[model samples]
Target: MEERKDINRLKVVLAEKKRTNKWLAETLGKDQATVSKWCTNTSQPSLEMLMRIAEALEVDMKDLLWPLKQQ
Candidate 1:
């Protein structure tokens, strides 16, 4: 079975919101380096964390996720 890797749209959302990585890091009480990883798609936040991020950014969770391609 092939593993599917979903793209993370964190950086785009942050850009649209005019939010900096530092701001998100501080808001989430996480390290700036950690948030940087998320922005670069080098790592991902958990679903719960994503929820908090969406709330903090005033956006829907779906807005932080890349659209899946139609198979």
Candidate 2:
């Protein structure tokens, strides 16, 4: 199996939560481009940032991370 390369589930979770990148950026006081990079998995957020993201998204921190393996 090809090990999954993507690190975060930000994009998927955003979609599930019906949130737009723009909304997240505005809510987090972040750059929209930065949020886009995160959603595309082109970059990652610091643990602190991730925690903040979880709060803004109203989701658990674990939900922002990809599972080791999905059955």
Candidate 3:
């Protein structure tokens, strides 16, 4: 499978938004463990989930992918 840029970028944006994993999970209607996995770069959110996260963070999806630009 192709790697996802959203993993680490989501973690950073979540931090900048002052959102905890538990808060993000609740906002996303997901389990905290799943949010934790996303934060730790151990897993990725689906496209639908990524859209939700982008909305929750009040950012465009491109912002999440921006962090990967130099890589």
Question: Which one is best on TM-score?
Answer: 2
Give the lowest summed-lDDT range of ten residues in model 2: 62-71
User: Could you tell me the TM-score of candidate 1?
Assistant: 0.83
lDDT of 2 by residue, 10-33 (tens): 999899899999999999999999
TM-score of each: 0.83, 0.87, 0.79
Q: What is the RMSD of candidate 2?
A: 2.7
Global lDDT of each candidate: 0.89, 0.92, 0.82
Q: How would you encode candidate 1's per-residue C-alpha lDDT over 1-71 as one tens digit per residue?
A: 99756567888889989999999999999999999988888889999999999999998898788754689
The clash tally of candidate 3 reads 0
Residue 37 in candidate 1 has what lDDT? 89
In model 2, which residue pairs have backbone atoms overlapping below 3 Å? none
User: If ranked by TM-score, best first, what sequence of candidates would result?
Assistant: 2, 1, 3
In candidate 1, position 15 carries an lDDT of 90
Q: Rank candidates by lDDT, best first.
A: 2, 1, 3
Top-lDDT structure, candidate number: 2
